[model samples]
Target: MTNLNPLVIAEIGKMANELIVTYGKYKETKEIEQTERIRIRATLLALTKKIEAETQTFQLFLEKRFEERHRLYDMAEDLMKHGMKEKDPDLINSAITLIKFTYCEDPLKGNSLLKITDTY
Candidate 1:
């Protein structure tokens, strides 16, 4: 068997202690990282729920607003009929324009069938 001097034995012990300290530090960092990930995931989930609630509220508002606009369109239609009877072409054209602007299926207005369904 090879002889080991006191200095060599001491050095080996020091290196082993250093490795243990390094491993402890690594474990602590991993635990902290895991905790942070959990917190971030919980925060994201809460935000998603809040967004969904807001989206539902906006959907209801859009429905009510659309109903009101539809009523206004019916009134405009009645006005247009009266104007036609009175031989006022300008009044008829104005009502037609209003209806078009209010009810037109516009891509820019996000009025696509799929978009409306997916949004809610």
Candidate 2:
């Protein structure tokens, strides 16, 4: 059996730790690394779920807003037509403002899909 002096063993252990720290070297087991990887994956999954829920809610709100804007546009166009026929300057001006506020073009009908945000 080889015998190591107590002080020498302690110094060697300290030196080993120092070497590892300074060199940025680490040992990882497959199971331990997999556990950590799974934890990270679970965290990412949770965040993805939350983002998906938020996106769905935002989409609903967006659809409702789009519909409301279209309704406002229709009202503005009707007012403009009526006011033009009657020569009402104030009504015409108000109709123009409403049209400006609600005048978004229809979305492109092709395959120009909206982009999803990228995750690291």
Candidate 3:
């Protein structure tokens, strides 16, 4: 129609959607197809959520790992400030061991492996 208000158009669209849902395909051959389409879209959305959650969990693991390294470095700096000239090799070795270790230590959390180099 001519110059319909946007709100009116939205309401009309909603009405059309309701009609389609209520009477469009229940008695026709398209019912199975429409249902399958909805099912597939739902499945895809679920999979996408799973992937996103996994990615976020992975990022949290990485952030925790970096925090761990920051703690270790801060420990070293504190030790140096106390007149120790060299970093204790044991601390560095511990960092290596921690990096290699994962969920074997945690009962509630599953650790994701993060690749950290020796530069820091």
Candidate 4:
């Protein structure tokens, strides 16, 4: 997955706010040159396109992450069921370890547990 930069998102938000203020100022001005009006309109259109694209990217990232989490949960459950049916202690232990790894908060700790589970 591509890494999402929070700073970039924040910068876009700041730029949007500035554009909104500029637009409001333009609306309040009594007399504005035709070229200046065109420029402002063009800028607003470009910004709107950029914001829409970024929103879609963020939404897709969220959806993918959600799907991955669900997939992991389902795998763990399947492992647990198979282990119980086979009357195998090792498989049951592996399933419990995977579940613990999934719920682990610390990334480093979780990674280690995941490595262990992956071996099974």
Clashing pairs in 3: none
Candidate 1 to native Cα RMSD, angstroms:
6.9
- What CA root-mean-square deviation does each model show from the true structure? 6.9, 9.7, 16.2, 24.2
Worst 10-residue stretch by lDDT in candidate 2?
105-114
What lDDT score goes with residue 65 in model 3?
A: 71
* Model 4: residue 116 alpha-carbon error in angstroms: 34
lDDT of 4 at 112: 23
Ranking of all candidate structures by their TM-score, best first: 1, 2, 4, 3
Pairwise TM-score winner, candidates 1 and 3: 1
Off by over 4 Å in 4: 1-32, 105-120
User: Against the hidden true structure, what lDDT does model 3 obtain?
Assistant: 0.66
Q: Please give the range of 10 consecutive residues that has the lowest summed lDDT in model 1.
A: 111-120
Q: lDDT of each structure? A: 0.80, 0.78, 0.66, 0.75
The residue pairs found clashing in candidate 4 are none
**Tens digit of per-residue lDDT, candidate 3, span 2-118:** 899999999999999999977766656577888899999998898789779978988877788767766755665564444334556665555455544532344224464344343
> What digit string (tens of lDDT, one per residue) describes model 1 on residues 1-120?
899998999999999999999999999999999999999999889879977986787687678767778787997898799889988999898888878877774423443323533332
Candidate with better TM-score, 2 vs 4: 2
Off by over 4 Å in 2: 1-28, 103-120
> How badly does each model clash, as a count of residue pairs?
0, 0, 0, 0
Candidate 2 scores a C-alpha RMSD against the true structure in Å of 9.7
Per-residue alpha-carbon lDDT of model 4 for 1-120, expressed as tens digits? Answer: 787699988999999999999988887673566668898999889878966986786666667666777787799899999999999989889988988887773433322223433221
Q: Comparing candidate 3 with candidate 4, which one achieves the higher TM-score?
A: 4
